[model samples]
Target: MSIHTFQLHDLEIGTLHDLLLDAVSDTKWKIKELRQTFDQTDQAALLEKLSSIEFNKARLETYTELLEQIDSSWCPDE
Candidate 1:
């Protein structure tokens, strides 16, 4: 699968949040499947991937909130 890259300034908060949520959800589903199959190595890899995804999702949420705050503070009322 090809990964897409985005500039932080270019992404809207909602879009970034949605993308991260989707990634976490997908990782969780794969982890569940690996667990059912009783594949120790695959299960370990999936668990690691799930952990990383969750960490990244938290970071993205923090950044998104900060960006929204900055935008609200700096932008004028229309």
Candidate 2:
């Protein structure tokens, strides 16, 4: 039998939201690590580069909202 690939639309909203949240969480954790490394390193140029990099706060808020919406949609009726 041949293997098949499916699109993201085939997944439930909850699954997609979970995946995005996990990715965002991982990225944030990595950023923290980078910050720590920058703090420990003595290279001024590297520290300046790290300080100049900007994070997309709006995108983060959007992902958080999406995760919240998915959780609310999946919650069982009380």
Residue-wise C-alpha lDDT for candidate 2, range 11-58, written one tens digit per residue = 567665675676577557657766777778858755644443333334
Candidate 2 off by > 4 Å:
1-6, 42-78
The collision pairs in model 2 are: none
RMSD of each: 5.1, 8.3
Q: Over all chains combined, what TM-score does candidate 1 have?
A: 0.49
TM-score of 2: 0.44
Please report, in order, the local distance difference test score of every candidate based on alpha carbons.
0.64, 0.56
Worst 10 residues of 1 by lDDT: 1-10
Best by lDDT: 1
